[model samples]
Target: VNPVDRWDGTPLADAVRAGHRQVVEMLSAAGAELKLDVSQTSVKLCDKAREGSVEGVRLLLDGSADVNAADYDGRTCLHLASATGNLMMTRELLKAKANVNSVDRWGGTPLADAVREGHSSVAKALLEHEARLEFDEVKTSSELCECARQGDINGLTMLLTAGADPNACDYDKRTCLHLAASVGNVAVVKRLLEHKAIVGAKDRWGGTPLADAVREGHEQVSELLLAAGATLDFSAERDARELCESARLGDIEGVKLLLAGKCAVNATDYDGRTCLHLAAATGNLVMAKELVAHGAGVSITDRWGGTPLSDAVHGGHFEVAMELRKHGAELKYSRLKTAGELCELARVGDTNLIRTMLAVGAEVDASDYDGRTCLMVACATGNMHVVQVLLDAKADPSVKDRWGATALADAVREGHAHVAKMLLAVGASIDLEPSEVVSRLCDYAGAGQLEHLELLLNCKADVDAADYDKRTALHVAASAGHLHIVEHLVSRGCRVDAVDRWGGTALSDAQREGFTHVCKFLEGRRQLVVLKRSSSQEQLNLK
Candidate 1:
């Protein structure tokens, strides 16, 4: 009478599925234990529970069916009832002594599902049953570093109070303390220090929290870190950047301070635009003359190949442009060029103009001094038609720019999967060095660049590749609170338990940072990894 069937369930479960209440009770009384696999269990039980079939559930429970017996996904009837907000079913399951804290495959507890689904009745009842909705599950401990980075003190406090580790470092080897200090969050620093976060912890680049504060010129944060015993090894770089801004704003006094501090008068900003360029562009004749007198080069070209005189002329500062000429700049070289026009057209997806240029014998592979071809420009902008035109005209997709970036790299970096596919079809190289692969993986994962991650995977990059800090792309995605990217990496079989140099796994990092969802996913994957290892050990032992 208790024999199992093809559906992997006993006669009582089959009778329950058939909805024969009399037969179900008859089978229950005849000693049938209600057991089932995924198909018969989660589906049938979920339907019965959601429909408030109290008698059916009671029949199974009274027939000695384990109330806590879960499906393959570890989902008990209680989880389903709580998720669907079926308070009636939840009460029935609870009355049968359901394990309220049972974690499903997705890391959902009955209370968590109840709370997430907004069934306060079920949630309160579960709480009364000794179910603790831990803050890690509720607030997503994966966001702790983000909270600290954003200066969300209340959120940080909640995460810390909920048991997130203060010293938990990210995939980049940076802790929440590092993020707070870098952003000049004095109150966050205080809270982190109170939690005993490592005062002198260094990042992957060996930059301490104090070093970050000092580099960003946050004097207050620097002072706080120093008081908490952090050391600094660099200064004056921020002032150099400030010099360019001061020159543009015509802050002559600030420029004087930078000059007095022996800052390089010719120091260029990130875009290779110097103080002379800014001063000239803003038509600040006094600032321009001061920079020129202090040895600013008028002939130096910026990233766009524009000289200071060119910037002044373009901005209608003819007077400043004339002054720059007097300051050892000779010719007003015309920035207008046919090749420049073609590249510009490609950038804006002007396919007809590009076609006309190509028809008129223009160099299809014409590049600027930076080695940026028209194809590279088109690919970076995801101009698929323009890229196709350039490709048909024999434009080299494999050409690398001055920064070693090819069309494929540019498309991937910008999340242009279609462009990357075209480049790949044309044999554009994905032959990156190990370091390049690691950099791309971490950068792409942290930025949530799914296209870039996919392109890297297509290139056969190692799913478990670690950076210098021993942190994988999975770790980076987890700490960034990017659950989608984290899931993608795990789907590709990344090691969830792969430990970083900070001795933190992806799950631990997510938990530390307040990404409870990421933690949940990683925790489930970790159990699978452990199970596989144990199975392998068993096989080896038998051998």
Candidate 2:
């Protein structure tokens, strides 16, 4: 008979807990069995070892304890020993022939766990024991790749030398080289190169190692790969799109290298955006200047019929817009007067520059392709100071955007309470449709500013109004797990059972979103008998 009862015994557990090695050994000989149900076992000896108690660990292991046994959480003795830098325990486990590569439930190998815990010595020991690198185990490779992506040369080199498959593609077909290049890990790139790794390997998105390096501004890694004969134009199938993305990312060296390697600088993307257009759209002045200097076409327009100058101004690149204007760029497709000039100035919040533009006859009320006036953009961005300048310049604040949404609507929708207050003070209408008003209230409530929501309510905005999805402020507060906001909304007499367009009540939405507190509050208000009983029982247990 097992001396320890299977269901209700703690002899082995108690001995380990008390750190009584002699008692543990004697009990083991006298037929004390370790519970295989790890939740009840002395396998947690590793936890004691991690806390720097070598004797506690020795008691269990010497008693024929399973050295490779894991805790309830799948954390092995090695994981604990390695994480805590207990080299003696580590050596003992290695002697006991513990599986060096066993991982925890979290996919954390001893080496990875050691590195994470800053135990370099333990990590070195695990490496020497031939702990498998490049964790090909389904649950752990991505994290291991992330380590390589960070250019941990010691870890990377160890993994590579330990027979880790360097070309093992991740779920996205991204090889280790792809990660190294993306992070500009020059040394790791060189090491991978020595292993004869495929230099031009493409990821799931068809992004090559060179493309990733260039896209991320990894110039040194790019040079290294180039010297190793990695194809610069290997992604020629999507060269135009890739180059545009590179320009949009502000990669000057990548732009230069691609251009030098004979990528068509003026090649249009699927959206008809050229390298210059991407540069202009992102406000990359240096890249725009460089593209222009390299003979990139300035006349290319996007699908929306807007040129590079339009992109620059719309994205708030004043200097880039000016540069493009100096290059004779046109805003012919824009409805705004002096579109390039005024939008750029407004974008920078440069009141003085805007005044200069106005003095020189730039149009004050010019609207964009989207029918958005300077004041609308200012209000949308919550740049109240800029809105004041535009307003003083006679820019119409009442002008609606393409959505029939005015500046006040934009401010409220984006939770700019101060801007909304200013707009309301300036005689902006508060009599919006009930649905729109409630949508704005939800936006404020979602940002956790009950004060803003209260202000909207005080302005005579409807509290029970529903948005396009028929979601009221109560629904928004509940879904965001803001218990206080839920309480406030409920206290304000907002309907607790208000259902959305999908026929889901606020209580259902809260439960779906994992908002337990909101669910409890809503359930409490509903007087759900079971929930009330459960709450009472919980309170009694607590007492």
Candidate 3:
């Protein structure tokens, strides 16, 4: 009698929610339709079923409700079933032609949901129903990830035997072996190795399984990896300093084994730092002596022309420094003549030893290849006592380094406000023209030294000085989201419209670096903010 009888509405949806099968059937016959578009309808059904209300789901299905109906976020009935791990309801929905691969707006499908949550039976059912095996072309079946994470050798073995790709990688190029090694699943790792999974396979950043094992301090896993013929000298990633890194960590046993396995004794890292350098830097007198005895080249100069002796002296390792000197390690070299030794001594506040070196005719004011004097090093290292000692020794404070940085510039660069004040008190000039003031200021701002920046500004440092790249301090501050610095620079009459060598404005740099706060600040100032198209814009837009 009612025209509304033909339309789906709340009463019939409520009947479905109540799980009253007879009432639901009567309502269906009376043409009381179930509302598919109601915001709470699908959610109620999902909630009922997830609460183990099997009758509710059956009644809804028999009434010809949308088997694949989605809630507000596009999570379908199967997604709810998988989430609740209701195997029977999930099987029934699959039999009714429910889309096994239907994903929420977040790209989470039934299989992904099941695997992520350890719904093993639901995951198996979905897989049997031909669910998509891979998610986003990189992350493999969440089932595999779960099994590896749980150390479930049996579950992992089953998945692999069921045609799961053992070699499938995650978004970070982390193969199953990487995950296994990370978790220290020795048995699972052995199985994977037996399956010929790439033992030396590198991840996105070039970390191998062995690297993972070592980093996590998994002793058994590390031993297994080493026994599997993983190259001891394998420098796959930032972990290239593997053996030396281990030694530096004081993994004496690990270091001994790695060295015994023929890792290069003098392998220099990206910084040209060797094992002996690290040992000396840490003041591990025993390790330093061991490395030297093992033929470590103590004389090998770092990128800064610093030897083991310099590292020891700089790190305050008097005993290690004495040991290195005993091994014929000279602090001063004719070539690459730098005050690295004196700077090292200053860094450790070793005034007595510094005087000893001076008494032995060590050049008190020698500059390095970069023309950085001991005074500049002292200022950069923020050691006030060392600065005073150097100043008293008649060290030149106004000398510029190869980078055109004076002692005052180094102090300001490192955000040592107290040290900068000390230098200023000693007649250090703050008005010298730095070759790349903008770049240096940008670096300092990026490091979050607002006080140091204030000091520079108060000294009336150039507000719009350009670096070699012609970028102003404003651009650097904007790019790095240093709002206070940007505000200060603007207050000091920095040109808001200045363009860098790349023709980018401060606003452009802010947007490029995704600095929303800086961008908003610049926009409020009515600055000409250019929106440049980045190569990764398409990807960002998709996200």
Candidate 4:
């Protein structure tokens, strides 16, 4: 019974595939063990279910085949049965203890697959088993839209009766009517009209169901929607503007309509910008591909003299930008120093985009027009993700901008202490001269940056350097009620007795600022010093 055929089909798998229910029962009685871990065994069960052999599936389950065994792609027999609309096979699998809510490696649950494959009965069965759904309403708008698109009248009625809003819209604001009209489902359209689905609803791009039908060349659907009060809402000038708007918004339907209407493929608006230009600028690769396929000029520049590829790169949309390059779009400059693009991406914390730019031959230390390196931009914006990626790419943290400030300087100046720690760890020098060290020390002390202040002290910065306001680290720390900094500075020999230009001693400032802890610490230190002096004088008298 364990012997395998050339196709690796065991006796049980072969019997199940051949639809021999009695043979499967006999094999189970004879103790022919199932290959639960073997991918081929699971594949055979799925294949039988996929072929709509309900008895074949039942036989396999009765013969001790694992109901939840999944194939290499993580799809169990239940998934296959549900996808193929085999309701009986699904029921048998579920009765055999199959997982109703199992998700595949691609995050597709059986319920999602069932709905997507238009298996309303199987979907209902899975829901009865408590299959997790993306929405808790009677049905998601996507499910309702799918039912209409596929002409499943029963599914549509079930969802609407269960309180799924007929007027429910998707992310692009397309309703069930829009989807039904787009696919030219006449009966579904009639059913949706009976349910009072809005006939004149405009999507995000102001395209109605009639416009959607026309765009898809569904003349019958268009006539039906128009008879039920759908409007055209399209003119020559409106088409040009809508094309640009749709391209920017990544609306594939609206772009297709403008293209079909023979609105010039290269039609330009007041900005002398074509749909390709808008698509590239907004990182809409779908619209970009469509425009290019319709013979939109890739090399054409806008009034600003920027081509589509240049605009894409400038917006840090490197994937779409690369797509443009694949279609022979010229680069405005060398790929070696795409600094402006890198800086923009770093500011937005797009580590993947920065990696893509570097992979395309961008220099790691490339600086923008303002001389700010990508690392500095990342540090200033507190994007630790981008900072880590730049550091891994061996970005030199020591490179200064036009202001002579390093990445570490920007991190410290911008109050990004964690970013400063990363910069310092990577050997970015904060080794300032004595004068600069004093200024920075005061800044750190006042801001309560304990770790950075400790690092500065380790670098031998003066503990008592006063700023232009004559405020030493102690005065600033005490005024800010930074108890830790006040204690650290005092330990490092900052003169607590010395007054600032404002005529305020550290203790006085602490008292005036209501820093009780700082006041107690300063008072304790003064008392200790006085007691030590008194002890010294007593010892001198004894001598």
The TM-score, computed over Cα atoms with residue i paired to residue i, of candidate 3 is 0.59
Among the numbered candidates, top lDDT falls to 4
Per-residue C-alpha lDDT of model 2 across residues 407-488, encoded as one tens digit per residue: 7776765567787788777777545566667767888778788866776776677778888888888888888988898898
Best by TM-score: 3
In the order shown, what is each candidate's alpha-carbon RMSD? 34.2, 22.9, 22.8, 19.8
In angstroms, the error of model 1 at 261 is 10
Name the lDDT of candidate 1.
0.76
Model 1 per-residue lDDT tens digits across residues 143-187: 567887888887676455534578877767788888887788999
Error of 3 at 256 (Å): 2.3
Clashes of each: 13, 0, 1, 0
lDDT of 3: 0.74
Q: Each candidate: what lDDT?
A: 0.76, 0.75, 0.74, 0.78
lDDT by residue (32-55, candidate 4, tens digit) is 755545576577688888888777
List runs of model 2 lying over 4 Å from the truth. 1-38, 62-64, 97-103, 107-134, 137-141, 234-237, 282-286, 315-323, 334-543
For model 1, the stretches where C-alpha displacement exceeds 4 angstroms are 1-32, 43-142, 149-155, 161-163, 178-187, 199-223, 230-232, 235-543
TM-score of each: 0.38, 0.56, 0.59, 0.42
